[model samples]
Target: MYAPRSPPPSPTSRQLAIIRFGLARIVPIDDEAPFAEIAAAAGLGEVHVRRLIRHAISQHVFQEPRPGVATHSAAPRLIAEDADLAAWVRWRADDCWIAAYHACEAVARWPGSEEPNETGFAVANPTSLTMFDFLATQPERASRFAAGMRLYAAHSDLDLQYLVKAWSWGELPKGATVVDVGGSHGEAAIALARAYPSLSFVPADVGGRIRYMIHDFFTEQPVHGADVYLYRACFHDWSHRYAVRMLQALIPALKAGARVILNDVVVPGPEEMSPGLAAGVRTGDLGMMILFNAGDSEMAEWARLFEAASSGFHFKGGKGHRAQGCGFWRQSGRDIVHS
Candidate 1:
């Protein structure tokens, strides 16, 4: 005989704005302030702050401590850890993205130069500042950015470890090499090497970042035959024209039948086609678009690039292959093999 509870209302645009404002202030969820204190800090009226917090909590961005107090929740925590999320939010709030939003107004007034790059503020407002560039200009932002990446890496590492463990490594030769392309700080390499003691790993990145790996190489080289190579993420941040150049750079060093791993997202189909999977893929794709205007490849795209490489190497069937929606190919001398 008890009355049924009503469903919470969906979030409104105004509520979303307030939530974003709150997120910029409160990071590292473990440290949170009282509602009144946060409201005053944000310069919003107490009633308005309360209403905004209430709405945010319902949307799972903020968690209410009691009736009036709230703290950051999983959604914001996930967002904080994501570099792309940070970049997207910054872009959306930035003058550049804001101007892009109003680009239609200018187009309506003058019909010429309709291309996004020509009219959109993202291109016109050339800050020449990448997220890393911003970090260089604003040291504090860099610290926050590093902290966010660490959080993301920690979470991602866990998932990667699980995948590594779940997949059968029988396909690999007894002493085969596993090269981790764009490996950051050697964490992924260390994890995989530790899990599969028999396998050798080479952690590759840019020259500056590789210095730390050089020290590790000298100390642990004999033990694991570990080597570090330097290549820039800058190439990956560009179009296929530059991405092909980046891939070509690896040709001289690659060994036949060696596993070359590209640890990046494989974009999914349209959102309407597969809601949950598409959401995850597009989330990553958008992040790439916002942060560097970089294009992350789909499986087919990866295969094409692999075929075009000097070695003409293709990715063979590997762990999480089907789930990732990626294709496989192989290389023999200059001939490319696709599956």
Candidate 2:
């Protein structure tokens, strides 16, 4: 009888590290390279490089064509061709991997902190600054985060087309300005500007109807009386209390008829989706907790958050209830939360 195949090993931090190490060392090569040459490129000894590569091979990340050479296998080859894929893996492996291990410790230390500075990421990295501030100081890493997040947004139902149609942009009066709060790289702003042509950041490429400026979300909203202030996939990065502050910060700018829209994840109900999709949302919630001590919330939790932030806000119902997970909320006489 044929021998039974062994099941693949469960993934661990070391396995992820091996995948990253192998990719960092191997994907840049045009073809298979000698182990020593690869090691030289990475400034590591050949024996160490070979050992890591061998482990990565078992994970189907890289390949050893002969006894001494390394090349990209199916997984690593895909990673080589796709910048988004590379960024996704690179960010998770380089940033999140360390933070995940300290999550329990962070929970024990901070319990229920609303401060971003008390996150597992803060514990693992030992920095005084919060994750976003730290990323701002690291240009290269920030760029990677932005790129990886583009891929993430696409996957997480944060598409530009989906967002555009979520609300009735056409109903708004012409020359209406929509502030894309926390709009990293301004992809959504750019998308909206194109569709409306009467609307208007990161590269200063936006002008006329759109303008680019650096403003902290924690600060009071700068562009007051705008028709809409949209926060896309932004609030989940903050703790419940911090998220409240984010909403509170916008209060001074909100006109009576102005809208604050949220395009983010609404923690899926147990019966609302299949187990697989539900698990995905739950995993995301866990990720938020690990990195920022924040998370996705249920509908009532969202309503309560609004109530806690300010009594001015109330659920105007999800205008985009069918937009997959990109449900949009419209709150009258105050702010909106769209998930």
Candidate 3:
């Protein structure tokens, strides 16, 4: 790949502006629509649409074949065609954008705070509740957020298949169980069962058995002595103090030799990856800080978290994987720390 040219002193803002403006909804994918026609369809004045589309062209969102006509480029075309993708863009442009803008103000208001309620998101949105709590009350925004996350997960390193293969689930004996702690919709658990029928899932070979129960991670773990207690993409949402509580809750239920698998992002060291990849990861890391007062951690932090929760947690260490990138921290609950 060729080197990226230095960006102009001021980059274009009209791409995200148009997306926020709902230009995607009115722009035709195949039609090389004229300026006035596009404006009329979008119910906007001709000058505004023309300016937005012209600026969007520079951002590689759309292109103008002639002075007065415009059509979709690859970027906007894909967004227009995919509803989930569009929602993701909108969510980014709206909620995330607001939070990012108010990040400094949030820090100023609640200096060095770890409370989820004391976040940029809370500041920008005027909520006493945290992001998840506030989202629950607003159904439309909640649906958009859910759809955005679905698209984000499917496209990002947090794909479900990665969690399935991050550990050797097949090594466990037949009829061995896996308790997916806070496994939303049991998607990771279901994928694991499908891969290794030895555990429970919809394989039909193991009687297609999968019991999904709602158990709070902050409370005690209900399923005791399972072969694997998996927390995929779960811990990063919480700060260290609370995350420790979640791990501690498992102490009573954890039996000797039971494995605790953490399938989550590990913060990369500087110069460890390409600029683009690192930027995305760093964006997520800071986004966690802004939204939840949480973070993607380093391996040392993971080890420390386990150690903090209980001295009995044997930190088997963690490694980066192609499937999950910097993910999967494995520890064995060889000794229980019962309070």
Best by lDDT: 3
Model 2 misplaced stretches (Cα beyond 4 Å)? 1-30, 45-47, 82-84, 137-140, 153-156, 197-207, 319-339
Candidate 1: residue 308 Cα off by (Å) = 3.4
On residues 52-168, what C-alpha lDDT tens digit does candidate 2 reach at each position? 778778777677888988887777677767776777676787788789888888889987777788888999888868898989898877877887877766664445776777777
lDDT tens digits, residue span 9-98, model 3: 223255456666667667777888888988887778999888878877877778888898988889888888888877777777778878
Evaluated at residue 7, the lDDT of candidate 3 is: 67
Candidate 1: pairs in clash: 205-231, 314-329
Decoy 3 TM-score against native: 0.86
Worst ten in a row by lDDT for model 2:
326-335
Would you estimate the TM-scores of all the predictions?
Answer: 0.56, 0.80, 0.86
What tens digits encode model 1's per-residue C-alpha lDDT throughout 51-123?
Answer: 7677767667678777766767876675656655564444444433444454555455435532223233333
Number of clashes found in candidate 2: 4
Pitting candidate 2 against candidate 3, the one with the higher lDDT is 3
* Higher-lDDT candidate of 1 and 2: 2
Candidate 1 local accuracy as lDDT? Answer: 0.49
**lDDT, each prediction:** 0.49, 0.72, 0.75
Better of 1 and 3 by TM-score: 3
